[model samples]
Target: MTPVSAPPIATASITGLVLAGGRGQRMGGADKGLQMLHGKPLAAHVLARLAPQVGVLSISANRNGDAYAALGAPWRAGVLADTLPGFPGPLAGLLAGLRAAQTEWLLTAPCDSPWLPADLAERLTHAALSARADIVTATTTNAAGEVSLHPVFALVRTSLADDLAAFLCAGERKVRAWYARHTAAEVAFADERAFYNINSLQELAELERA
Candidate 1:
């Protein structure tokens, strides 16, 4: 009898989701994902990095769906809108991702973080599987020994969709708070720059100059 080999991690059981549903108030209300970054949209950069790490891909955007849809075209990524209205928050985007993903796990990163680490999904999935956790989030330590949790960069089980939806319905918008209620693990990353997110136009300009 011939033995079969498992599929590569890139086409295994994970789906990548880029969170771009924010109001972008800090960017002067501009669509941050649509913003130009090195001649391409910011979300495009995120998708390019994330698409190869998962079996499927998606984008969470509240407005300008057409533009986001265009950015997702190369990957055949689904563009999801918040089922709940009023531009709630990233949690809303997460909920949409959890529901839309066809894979057992969903890996997420903010669209603004164009420099997100390429190993994000691999590391998080390894941690989650090893710890048998429902969620795995990325964390970074500063020179001063301060640990910062980047909750937006996370891997979650699709089975938690119901629980997340309930939490959102209870008016809970806090990502860490919701995470605390689940079996969560934190994976430390050495490169903090990989997680740096541009919040303002000035920051974008500075990064561009860099």
Candidate 2:
């Protein structure tokens, strides 16, 4: 009898998701992603940096999906946010993206964080795979040498969608708390300023001036 060969395993493919679903209450209820940063909408900068790093991309916005669609690169036209009600925060975005993802992995970044690293997806993917972790997040050290995890900036397995959905249904919304339930890895980035996000008018001004 001839011996049977095992099937080849499929390689992982990553899709990018930009989280822009916040109400921007701190920025006076404005659409923060559409707000200006260096003469461009903040999401534009993020899209430019993140588009080249993934196979496909999507955004998560509670409103103004048309404006977000317009900011997508030429090749990425027609891409729009997966709308979810109530703006349950970044986790809702993550869950929506995961459920909608066409790939095995989902890489996420916030729209208001314009200066995200060009290597964000690559590094997070590497860390997760190397550590055999379910999730990998970008981390940065502040001037005081305090390390902080940017939970929204991460590479996550799409397979965790059910688990995340359950977590959310249980009223658990904290990103860190959810990550704690899984095997997670962290990759440190040297630039602390890279993670500086625009949460208010003053913060936007600081980034604009820089």
Candidate 3:
């Protein structure tokens, strides 16, 4: 598919946050973001693909802040998962990133998805702005041809940080639970492989060979 041109939204008002704070239990507890994919760590690939899509780029990592900083991004900033306790999932990363982000919008992408599309931010921003929605997430078709939401691959309004903090404080962890309270828009992509994330060594190896 042909890539879309950059949308009319100001790039400086949006920040890209790479979600690298996962526990990675499926990969034998290895840092999934740091795992090698085609001789480059997964985070590096993600950063390379996402950096140009925003004005600033930062990483939300629970560990190895130094390594993620070394991913060759000159405009990089690092935010530790400190908003909530006990690795409270991707929302914690999102909260911490929201606190650190200077932009009005925050775009999040998983560090494990090395082949993320180049027009992700542009498309999401376009969709959100058109619908006047607070959250815009990426959706892709599965093998059965059914479209599904990928919450981690989302563009959110940073103004909802306090609402998110309250939600987490109430012990709610499911992303959809919080999503239900907001007006969200989904921008679907035709290529299912674009949303495929590596959760295990076998999947990583298969992606490498593919």
- Model 1 lDDT per residue over 1-210, tens place: 443233234456888889999999999999999988788989999988787787878999999998888875667558999999999999999999999888888889999999898778777877887898999999999999999999999998899999999999999999999999999999999999999998999988887787
Cα lDDT over the full model 1: 0.88
The ten-residue window of minimal lDDT in model 3 covers 77-86
Instruction: Quote the positional error of residue 164 for candidate 3 in Å.
Output: 0.3
After superposing candidate 2, which stretches have Cα over 4 Å from the reference? 1-12, 73-84
- lDDT accuracy of residue 93 in candidate 2: 87
- Ranking under TM-score, best-scoring first? 3, 1, 2
Residue pairs in collision within model 2: none
The global C-alpha lDDT for each of the candidates, from Candidate 1 onward, is 0.88, 0.81, 0.88
Please give the lDDT score for candidate 2: 0.81
For candidate 2, the 10 contiguous residues with the lowest summed lDDT are: 3-12
Provide the lowest-lDDT 10-residue window in model 1: 1-10
What local lDDT score does residue 55 receive in model 2, on the 0 to 100 scale? 77
Off by over 4 Å in 1: 1-10
Which residues of candidate 3, in runs, are more than 4 Å off?
1-3
**Top-TM-score structure, candidate number:** 3
